[model samples]
Target chain A: MSQDHSLNLKNSHEDPAKATMEGKNKFLGLWFFLGGETVLFASFFATYLSLRESTAGGPTSQELFGLELVFIMTVLLLTSSLTSVYAIYHMKNNNFKKMQLWFGITALLGIAFLACEIYEFAHYIIEYEFTFRSSAFGSAFYTLVGFHGGHVVFGLSWLISLMVRNAKRGLSLYNAPKYNTFAIYWHFIDVVWVFIFTVVYLMGMVS
Target chain B: MTDNTNINKINSYENTRRKEEMKHQVITFVLMIAFTLIAFLVVAAELSRTFVIPFILLLAVVQVGFQFYYFMHMKDKGHEIISSLIFGGIWIAAVTVLTFTTIIWW
Candidate 1:
């Protein structure tokens, strides 16, 4: 066998995303970062739950949240998660084109989610006079969900930059782990949204 | 001739492994979608708030598991660090939620 074949043999035992030491380090570091993010979100959730009922004669969740809209947003974000999985799957298979295509779809879905969120906020502000300053409930609601929307914005920009910078280089030792870590981050966002959908939207609607 | 045969075997093995991985990803994706739909339906049906809240939260918990285990590849070998980090975070989050719900409110 040639030298290239020997190198391939070395990587055969590990995942493509972790074929190198650097990749392993990045993957591990990103997970730790997400762990910190979990506590941050937990603090927000606790505050929101404590303040959720303190509308002070202002509009409450039952009066503000529309199940249909929130449901659509949930579906969009969940589908984006699936698309990102597909992207990483393609990355594993060494198909850069397919990976890019799937990531593009994921970003598009994220954009749609953001648009729906903005519209939902605008509708609340205009129809129900539910600004962030309206009441304690308003303040908590905006902080919790607004923080999530900000994450989506940051993730979308990150994905776009990664795709553009790597558009021509294709997947390699340097970029495979980057894509892999991004996929993990994207999944973490989806996981957080799952809780938001259940705790904030579904629970709020029923309560 | 023996070297060629050995190369072929390695290639086939890699292909088989990839197929297995793809199957797992697809299954996880389908299950996550199903969980989302059930959560929506539970809320839309206007069931008892008590029942719906816990039920939807359980479904969400399952979906999160699928995301972390399958999509994030934490179920694979060599992910112990990630698992520890995530579970530790969960422990802290649970404590925070409990403290708020019990102590602050009560």
Candidate 2:
């Protein structure tokens, strides 16, 4: 009976995030999911790169890309990644309040990124008349970057949902893993953005 | 009394481990910022495309490594599954890019 009591207390006191069998399985499964996501993005990248030069007499990358605005967008998203890191740090410490705070900052930053992207797309359409249907390059550009922007939107919604659903309950073994996996997803999104910034924006500006 | 002591010991160990992890994360974040600055500077300065392109890509590669190993916590124990899977994904990506670029050019 004493052994059973000790075992129960030990389980209760352990890290809630990885304490349960279900949580561990979810964690591992998500990593594999991300692996598949990597391949999906890779194929997109390949397609984009292949068709990048096929402008079909429309605005080319060099004609449309402005470095300053993209630079700001990059900074915002990168800082959001850092804020998410802080959130996870707090999560590890089991500091529910601080974790939520940092995650909130992360969500705000992501929103700012989306806002910048919207403005960027608007500027492209209004100033340059570069629509997705304008040329092959246009299609490739929108599909690649727009896909990433779609992910940012999804990530933001996921984050907000996690925050709202768990606000009253505080951190527990169940929701802790949920938060952790969401963080992993956020980091992957940022990682994809990193590539987009480099291959699409930076390289486009230079070439 | 023994149980209390054991619990305290475990707590202290976890605390130290967490501190070390935080330090690594902060350092990685700083390095990533520096990499970003270098990438921007290379382009803003209008260096030769040949040099600027490769240099910025190299920086990006390093930053990706840091993002995966540090921010994603792939360096921690029991993360071998994640690490292997990600690397496998990368392998496939590399092959796809190579195949497309080569075949299209030919």
Candidate 3:
């Protein structure tokens, strides 16, 4: 343990003044955090996949998922991911104004995506009478996709806060790391959506 | 101190470079959206069940890869170690899901 600490300290010498060791620690810590989040979503995915075939006299993926709407939602979220990339690019360049602009756009896209998702769920519940209580499959499907939607909500809030808090101050070394970390989180969410699209939507529809 | 001044200079240089890179990032972003929309259309159209699902999934995976490597800059800085950790965790989770599915279903 002591040797590891010493090694870390030695390496810290290279970028010592740039980001404090605390910053590195935060980065490392966030990675671990994301690991936990992976497990959480994995469990949800597993449950959804396992219960996927259990239509239970209710709507299955094929019956429920309209490719058109799902496709639109995917486009909205994907565009949001791109906007976030722009935000982070500005962040790296220390272009605070541009970063804020891009971040704001990203947040708006996220909001649009979330609104679509909510409407989709409402359509599911109202039209099909398929809901969390309808069947085990319904429960699993809603829980998995709804959990992701929840994350999008949280991410939008986080983006908004970062944008508002740092708007006037501009990007400092301190705030730069904050935006950097936020970008990491946002991209991770996008990654999970990719898997959800594949396993939950595509596979569910087919199998 | 000279060190502080030098650090400031380096930061300013990085700032300028990042600004220049923003355009490229936006371009990449646009491409990603296009790819995603195309994949969605392919899936929705139900071009061919056997081929289409896998193909769209593959496209989605590629887009995710682009988001990770380019937008997140996972290729730069200390990202290797963190990314590996993430991948490792994913592998384990995947295996666990496979095992559970086999046990429960079979």
Candidate 4:
């Protein structure tokens, strides 16, 4: 029933070192978040793999996939991941202008990637006649990849908000952690796309 | 009064140092992008799906490692316990998925 003095004491003595410690905690917490996201995608992937062959008279991965476009989209997302790194780099250096510039680039690349993905999905649905209801394989495939695309959309929004909010203020201990956390999330999204390219596209095409 | 002035000077110096370290974070970020793009190209080319799939995944895994250790500072001493717990959760999730799929299908 007694109030906790230790917690209050720590808060009262908050120094730069303490701020750094808090940043580390935020980073670790985000990692745990990404871990859960990994499992979420894993389940979708397993389901997709299981149903990959059940084309149900629909076009198969080999029949539908064109490597050239997927390749370009992949490049865009990957580059965005890199740009976000640059943003974070500027963040650490206390260079707010440079951080905003790089984050802007990252967000632009993410949008481009999303556009390509949407186009690709539309092509599949309209041209290839690959609807989610086409088969179990179709359902799982769209669910998994679509979920990732959704994450990209969400990330784009987050990046935009961060950029707009911090456009004038510049980097602070407060915003630096936000930028850092966003980078982690962006990288995690990129990582998931990697698995998707492998398990969903590559494996589907080959086997 | 002298001690207080010294403390402020040291604090400013530390702030500058921290900024420099953050600048170095750019290198790791660029490397992550390069790895990601290459993996994308490899997978997209449809180059020996058998090898490329695992290779691309491996590249991705490496990128994740960079984000964790460098950007996320997983190597920081204070985060050891939390990191282990996170890895533990991933392990459990992996096992559960594998078990369910294998048991039900096979």
- Stretches of model 2 off by over 4 angstroms after superposition: A1-15
- TM-score for predicted model 4 compared with the true structure: 0.79
Q: What root-mean-square deviation over C-alphas does model 1 reach? A: 2.4
Clashing pairs in 1: none
- Give all TM-scores, in the order shown: 0.93, 0.94, 0.84, 0.79
- CAPRI quality level assigned to candidate 2 from its DockQ score: medium
Candidate 1 error regions (>4 Å):
A1-13, B1-8
Q: Give lDDT for model 4.
A: 0.74
What are the runs in model 3 whose C-alpha is more than 4 Å off? A1-18, B1-27
Interface RMSD of 3: 3.7
Worst 10 residues of 1 chain A by lDDT: A5-14
Sort every candidate by TM-score, greatest first.
2, 1, 3, 4
Per-residue error for A76 in candidate 2, Å, reads: 1.2
- Looking at model 2 chain A, report the run of 10 residues with the lowest lDDT sum: A1-10
lDDT for each of the candidates?
A: 0.86, 0.86, 0.76, 0.74
- Model 1's alpha-carbon lDDT is 0.86
Residues B33-64 of candidate 4 have per-residue lDDT tens digits of 68856765675566875688778767767876
* Candidate 3 DockQ vs. native: 0.44
Q: Write the per-residue lDDT of candidate 2 for residues A20-91, one digit (tens) a residue.
A: 777788899899999999998998888888888899999999889988898899889888988998898787
Question: What is the C-alpha lDDT profile of model 3 across A32-134, one tens digit per residue?
Answer: 8888888888888888878888888888888888776776777777777777777766555556788899889888888888988999999999999999999
DockQ of each: 0.70, 0.70, 0.44, 0.38
